[model samples]
Target chain A: EAGVAQSPRYKIIEKRQSVAFWCNPISGHATLYWYQQILGQGPKLLIQFQNNGVVDDSQLPKDRFSAERLKGVDSTLKIQPAKLEDSAVYLCASRRTSGSSYNEQFFGPGTRLTVL
Target chain B: GQQVMQIPQYQHVQEGEDFTTYCNSSTTLSNIQWYKQRPGGHPVFLIQLVKSGEVKKQKRLTFQFGEAKKNSSLHITATQTTDVGTYFCAGARGWGKLQFGAGTQVVVTP
Candidate 1:
């Protein structure tokens, strides 16, 4: 089975510029998530989507970051006026909502954003 | 809000030695999952413990959940070069909300 897929494995942008990352989760997966992983730290959940609806986004910085999953299959995360502190890897993950093996998450390669 | 914490931010172990990493959570978890991320790679799921005081093994890796369900541990036996990576523990208070720990970076030397 194919795993989660993401685009632009690496990206570079200037401070104050806008950047967007894309994610295509595994087929038939019902839950999708976006995470920001800073250097030397574990992934921090940015937002979570449950079939086109947001499940949680309390940690997301609404002033600068936004994400959407229109069809519940693919998702896009955008950051406007990117800051140097936003330089980190953005990871996408998916999980099966039901069944015996629902807890395991499949992660994508991630998009490394470097804001100069 | 829930928080998960890991100890020994970094560990350097001999190739044949055994080492253990720990995960602690501020709130009791319904389940705890472990993942491994190689340098420059994405995290891959290793295992998950759901029941309190549960222990599971995958080859040389042993995973244990504390009786209180507030902590977990990953013990690797006879560490190998292949074990070089960061191990992360994510605890979920509810079903689908996962709070991840900072992770323990392990380096094995020959």
Candidate 2:
């Protein structure tokens, strides 16, 4: 069984540029999450998807950040006109749903983005 | 807004010493989870506590959820080099969303 997969382990861009990160959760997992982890800080949940429908995205910056988990398996997070504050690691995670609850999430290696 | 806070942003201990990190939440949490992230690595789940006043142990690690369900603690006995990492506590309110603490970075001196 493979773990969560994320594309382009690292990326570099300048301010106002655009960048996208991709993630593939573990198979059979029904819940996927995208989190941002800044240096010296814990991960902050940006968006969550249950199957193909979004469950939560209140913390996501709608003006610049957007994410979609189409087909309920792979997800893409896009940052248009990236800012310097966007320099961080973007992590993707997935969890199995049981009855009405979700289990612990397994995370991907994450894409380290550096905005110059 | 729900906020989770961890005490002692950083910790340094000798190899044979014990270490502990405390987490507190502004609001009652439905559950609390612990994760460990090594330097330059992603977070890995260590354990989760769902019941009030719950205490769970794994090998040399012990996790406790407060009776009030708003606080938790992680203790490591006789710490070793392998225990080096940032320990984070996440509090979940209902489902899907998790509020994470800033984390406590542990450094063990050989």
Candidate 3:
């Protein structure tokens, strides 16, 4: 089975510029998640989608970050007017899961965004 | 707000030496998870502990959950060169959110 797929493995952008990251989840997986990982830190959850509806996005900075998963398959996270602090790896993961039980998450090679 | 902490932010161990990282939570957690990230790779889940005082093992790696579910540990027996990476312990306060620790970076020398 193919793992989660993310595009543009690396991106460099200037602060205040807009950038977008995309993710294609593993086939048959019902849950997808996006995380931001900064240097010397762990990946922080940005958003989660169960099917097409968002399950959680409390950590997403609504002022600058927005994400969508149309038709419940692929997802895209965008940061407008990106800041220096937004420089980090954007990771996307998927899992074969149900509303109840724990499932193992499979991650894609993240898109490393560098804000200058 | 919830937080997770890990001790010995970085550890350097010679091959065949044992290494352990501790994870503590500010509040009791519903579940705890462990992940390993290669130098430039995304985190991959290693194990999850849901029950207090539960212990699980995967090969040389051992995971233990504290009796109060507020702490956990990962001990790797006889570390190898392949063990070079960062280990993170994340605690879930609820179903949808997780607070992760700063992670313990491990470097193994031959």
Q: List TM-scores for all candidates, in order.
A: 0.99, 0.98, 0.95
Cα TM-score of candidate 2: 0.98
Q: Largest lDDT belongs to which candidate?
A: 1
Residue pairs in candidate 2 whose N, alpha carbon or C atoms collide under 3 angstroms = none
- What's the ranking of the predictions by lDDT, best on top? 1, 2, 3
Docking class of 2: high
lDDT of prediction 3:
0.91
Which candidate comes out best when scored by DockQ?
A: 1
Stretches of candidate 2 exceeding 4 Å from the true structure: A99-101
Query: What is the docking quality class of candidate 3?
Result: medium
Expressed as tens digits, the lDDT of each residue in A20-48 for candidate 3 is 99999999888899999999988889998
Regions of model 3 farther than 4 Å from truth: A99-101
Better of 1 and 3 by TM-score: 1
Clashing residue pairs found in predicted model 1: none
Q: List the residue pairs that clash in candidate 3.
A: none
